[model samples]
Target: MVFVVFIVAAIITFAAATKLSTYADALSRLSGLGSLLIGTFLLAVATALPEVTTTVTAVFLDNPDMAVGNILGSNHFNLLILAVFDIIYRKRKMLAHIYKQQRYTALFGVFMTLVIALAIFMRLDIPILTIGIDALIIVALYLLSLWIIQRTPVPEQEKNHSSQEEEYSLKHALMGFIIMAIIIFISGTALTLSGDQIALITGLGSSFVGSFLIAGSTSLPEVVTVLTAMRLNNENLAAASIYGSNLFNMLLLVVCDLIYRGPILQSISLSHAVTAIFLLINSSLVCYAMFARKNRRFYTWPSLVMILFYILTMVWLYYSS
Candidate 1:
């Protein structure tokens, strides 16, 4: 029964995520928002719905470690999705096309890494106030991205776009958004329950189940979307979505902590340390690939390197834990 629930939830999660991405793209076009702003804010928030719902549910169930582990684990898995996207774009070398805009994605990736590192390494007491601060940071960064986009000059081709092409029907998009949100909420809850049952049956910890299984399962949506986007020649959207999702995950942690009330740091596990190390290494590689313009543009080698590193890290974590 538990295994069945896990499978069902995974299916729902994938469907919901696809719908959410479609709606997000439409809404962005309607709102006249640049990819950077829409990707970082609206799309980011939508993709992270599962994380938010699952973590909140775990916290309410008094499984704080599971909640934190899910976020950390999801972040680690999200980085792996970048490699997955690269693999899908093998022939075209997706990164080659975005040599100019890669810097923005790299910067966002670095910022997300710093935020996660601070959460993991800093020994400061996790107060509710910290959540408010984190929320402010997220909002500020999103607004800043929008400002930058607005101030930047648009290319001549973009300036001549028709009004009909830019505007999306809001009623249809909103309906789709709501439907996706319901699916994500329901599926995430089912997955959380399944995780708890598996932990109980196997005598494994909830954090262990949430981190390795649940986190990886739930992140499939982001992985599939990125790979699909890459295949469709939407390299910019793929990169934006990946980075956007990371920022959303990090910010959601703050919200989860605040809502759960008091000292979240106390519940954080050593698994977070391993996850953080992997994130730092993966993010550094991304930044390097983006900035190292003189090097060969092909991401085949870098993608392989990331996959190997992720696998090794997982192996080490499993044995060590």
Candidate 2:
């Protein structure tokens, strides 16, 4: 029964997520929002809706480990999606043409992940009027990231998407995006509950299950969105989505802290720091790949290395847990 619920949730989430990318693209074009900004802010938020829902649900369920793990694990998974992008993008080096705007976004992810690692290790007892200092810092940084991404100059081609031919109107696109988001919210909630139950049934730590299974499930939207963006030949959007999703994933810690009964960061297992480390490394790899401008036969060396590291990290986390 638990397995059935999980599979069903995954299917529904994927179906909704496929629609999510399409409407998000339409919204970008109709609104005249550059793919960089839309991919980072709007599309990133839309694709990350599942993570937001799942994290909040985990917190309300009193599963801090699951909440934290899901976000960090999803962060890693988002970057892993890039590796897939590189393989499929056979024309040119995938990361070579990624917009310069994403440089700041990637760096911001590193900064936020570092903050999370610090919070986990420090576990500060100090709270400002009931809110942990770390939570406040994370929220502040996330807002700053948003500002930076918004202000960055978008290339002319990206800015002129509004002039391009699109299939949906602004109103219809908004409506479709909202409907898909609602479906994702419902499916993600179901995934969270079943994931929690599965953790218990398997006698595995929430950190393990949340980091691997739950994280992968919640990240379905991102994977679909990234692939869809690539198919459209908007590699910048695909790249930005991954970077922006990582930033959004970190921001979700604030949401988790707010809904959780206690200091969410302090309550999470230190094992999650391992996951954070992987996220930081993968995010940094993105920066390196973008600047290195190297291309390979199938995929770049960084892509392969990052994927290997992720698999190894998952293996280690599984046995360690």
Candidate 3:
């Protein structure tokens, strides 16, 4: 029964994700919000709906580790997706072309990593007030990002693309967006329940299951969007979606803490700590790659380095925890 539920949940999740992506793309066009902004804030949050819902549910049931593990595990899996994207889009080197906007996106990622790391290492008690404060900060950052983007002039080539694309009808897109959101919510709830059941049956602990299996399951939307975008030669959107998702995941930690209604920092398990550290390292490397002068274009070496680093991190996490 548990396995059956898992399969059902997976199917629902995949279908909803595809629909959500379509809605998000359409909405971005209608809103006149550049793909970078939409990808980073709007679409990223929509795609992370599963993680948000699952973690909140886990915390409500007093399974804090599951909540922490889901986010950390999701982060690790997200990096793996990057490697996959590189392999699938071998000729284009998607990361290189998107590095221009990625600079800010990567910085936001660094900020998020730092916040999570501090919460983990310092063992800070995140009170409701702190969560509220973090939420406000996220809102402010999002608004600031928009203002910056609005002020920054688009290049002639980018402007041409923007102008040439067919304008999306707001009413139609909104209807699709609403329907997709409902599906996402329902599927996310079912997936969370299935994940809980699997953890109980396997006796592997909910933290492990949530961090690895459940986290990977929820990140499928991101993987699909990136791979499909790459195939379509939408390199910019692909990169935007990947990095955007990371930023969204980071911010969701604050939301999770708020929903958990306690000091989430103190509730995190040791395994979660390991995952957080790995995320920090991964984000750092990405930041370095973006800023590095020579080899600005993502070469084979950095990609290989990232893959090896990811493997080692996972191995260490498995052994240490």
Candidate 4:
């Protein structure tokens, strides 16, 4: 019965998220916003609504480890999106170019992952008014990262949206984005709740379930969004949406910390450090891939390593959990 509910909720979430991607692309065309900004702020947050809903709900249910696992797991899962794209489009000239902002965004992701890992390892958390200072730093760093990315100038060649479709009103696009976001939020809640119940029934442990299962469930929208952006030749949109959501997932720690009634980072299993370490490694590899001249060859070695590493990390975590 729980499996049935998971399937239904996943379908609804995926369907809404697919529509959400289209609306986000429409906004990119109609708003005159830079593609990265639109992808990072709008589409990234839209796709991240599941993490927001799932993580917060986990904390509300007094499952801090589950909440934290969802964020860390989602960040790593988001990085894996880049690997999947690289493999699928390999040997094609598509997505052969790299953007400076993407490199910066990925670098920021690496740094943020490092911070979380170190915080988890050291556990020297000081709480101010029940909120950990580490949480504050994570949120502050995320905001700074956003500011830097926003100021980074867009390449003139990538600025124009060249679709020949009939004009889409910004009003209609905004409405669709909002409606889809709401549906995704509600359905995501169901997805996570079912995932939690499944974790209980299957005895997989919330660490495994939240990080692997629920995290993957919530990230389904990103798969659709990235595919649509690549289909449109908007590589920046795809890349930004992936790395941007990773950064947002890091910020989710603070949300969990605020809701969990304690220093959320210190309360979770140290096993999450496994996730943090792996996340740092994956993000760093992505950063290297963005700058490596080999990236121009259209056959990416780093992506291959990343794909394998993601699988290895998940296997390692499942057993450890």
- In terms of lDDT, the best-performing candidate is 2
Candidate 2 lDDT (Cα, whole model)? 0.83
Q: lDDT tens string, model 1, 148-236?
A: 54465433332233254534487888788778867776788888878867777876666566677778877867876675555545565
Question: What value does the lDDT take at residue 320 in candidate 1?
Answer: 49
What is the full ranking by lDDT, best candidate first?
A: 2, 4, 3, 1
Per-candidate TM-scores read 0.84, 0.94, 0.87, 0.94
Q: Looking at candidate 2, what is the lDDT of residue 90?
A: 38
Name the candidate, 1 or 3, with the larger TM-score value.
3
What local distance difference test score does each model get?
A: 0.67, 0.83, 0.69, 0.82
Candidate 2 lDDT by residue in tens digits, 1-321: 999999999999898888777777777677877778888887788778889888998888898999999998998888888886785673567787787777888888888888888888878767876778887888888889888877877688776666777898899988998898888878888899999999999988898898899999989988888888777777877887888888888888887777777789899888887777777788788788776665434447788878987997798789877
* Per-residue lDDT over 169-285 for candidate 4, one digit per residue giving the tens place of the 0 to 100 score: 789889988999898889888988888899899998889888999999899889888888788677778888998899888888877777777788888898898888888888888
List candidate 4 segments past 4 Å from native: 92-96, 162-167, 293-298
Clash-forming residue pairs, model 1: none
Q: Model 4: clashing residue pairs? A: none
RMSD of 4: 1.8
